[model samples]
Target: SLANAEKSQLEKELEAEKEEVETLRDNLRNRDKMMKDRIAMEESNRQEAERRMGGMSKKQMQSMEERAKSAEEEVEKSRKLVAEMRMAYTVALVQSRFLRKAMEKLNLITGVTKTENQSLSLRLSNAQKDLNKMEEETLNLKEELAKTKEKVAEAEEKVTHMKELVETMEEGIEER
Candidate 1:
């Protein structure tokens, strides 16, 4: 019974582990998607900023250049963030693959255990049948034994009656 409980616990643990791994994968995908969206938004903003700088005077142009430099720095930061997101996605992919392999191994082990349990159950059923058959045969043999004992007792009684008859016949001959 303890072993059965342990097996059930292990199955629940495996299912929970699988669900956790899937949740991690989904979170990683969502983060990567959000990072890409942010990068795209930053690129669009940089383009719009450049278009605004196109119609400015000299002083305005210098100020625009400064602003453009800042935008470039921000864009660079966004790029770094994207790169980190990519790396994280890669790591999550690898981890997901590892988890899937582990799940497969667990499934294989569970299958083998089920097969073995079925085999043992069949063996036990066969043994029980054999035992039942032997018990029936023993009952039959006991009945036969009782009948043989009765027959032996009858034969012994017949032998005793024959002895008495023989003695009476001999005694009568002696009297004559």
Candidate 2:
């Protein structure tokens, strides 16, 4: 019963962990999509800036460069965030796998132990029955032994009385 309870608890926890992992995976996928979109937008903006550079005034060009630099920095930041999220997701996945394996092993061990315990219990019961039977046989043998001793004692007493009578008869005949 304890093993079953533990197995149920482990299964519940494993289910929760799997759900959490799925949620993390979804979040990671969303972040990846966003990162890809931002990268594409930044590339498009860079191409537009290049096209406008031909007739642009000095100040305009400077402003465009600054804006492009800012966008690049933002893209870089987004890349870093994506990378971090991926790492987190990977870690969560690894943890979930480890927990699953551990739970499986625990279940296996519990099953084996339950089987062994049942077998041992059965063997103990059989041994107890055998001991009871042997005890009963011992009691019967003791009673029979007592009866045989009584008969042997009676036979010995009769033989002793007969020997005494024979001796007395011999003496009386010799005296006559």
Candidate 3:
């Protein structure tokens, strides 16, 4: 019974760990995609800004210059964000790797559990077969006991009949 309960608990724990690992993997995948997309988008925006920098009036050019400066600053900020995102991605990857390892461990435990369950099932089957055999033997013993009782009863009756016959014969002989 302890083994049965322990097996059940282990199964539940393994399932929860599996779900956790899947969630972590999904997060890692999403973060990787998001980082790549952000980097590509930032590069495209920078190129477009550079091309537009060519067409402008003197006054408008001054404003354009200021805008360009701001854009550069924005780009710098975006670069930093990308760096941070990359770091975050790396961290996520490391965590995902760890989670994968944990999942592997869980898989190993499940394998052990599978074997244990198989063994327990085999043992139970053997025990059931033994029990069946014992029940059959008990039935045979009961039948044999009943037959022995019948034979004993029959033998006792025959002995009584012989005794009565002997007494009757002796009386007849004495009377003569």
Kindly give the number of clashing pairs for every candidate.
0, 0, 0
Off by over 4 Å in 1: 55-116, 119-176
Q: Write the per-residue lDDT of candidate 1 for residues 36-111, one digit (tens) a residue.
A: 4544554464455446533444564444345445544544554454455345445444544454444444344543
Which sections of candidate 2 miss by over 4 Å? 108-176
Candidate achieving the largest lDDT:
2
**Regions more than 4 Å wrong, model 3:** 1-112
> Can you write out model 3's per-residue Cα lDDT over 1-176, one digit (the tens) per residue?
55455544544544454454345445444544554454455446445544654443346434434443443454354445445434543444454344344443434454346787577556445544544443444344334434433433443343344344334444544555
Estimate, for each residue in 1-176, the C-alpha lDDT of model 2 and write its tens digit.
77656655755665565465446545545654654565465456546644653454556545554554555465455445545544554555455556555555655566557786575446435544543443343344334334433433443343344344334444544555
lDDT of 1: 0.46
Q: Clashes in model 2: which pairs?
A: none
Best candidate, TM-score-wise? 2
Question: Which pairs clash inside model 3?
Answer: none
Residue pairs whose backbone atoms clash in candidate 1: none
Q: Rank the candidates by lDDT, best first.
A: 2, 1, 3
User: What lDDT is reached at residue 129 by model 3?
Assistant: 55
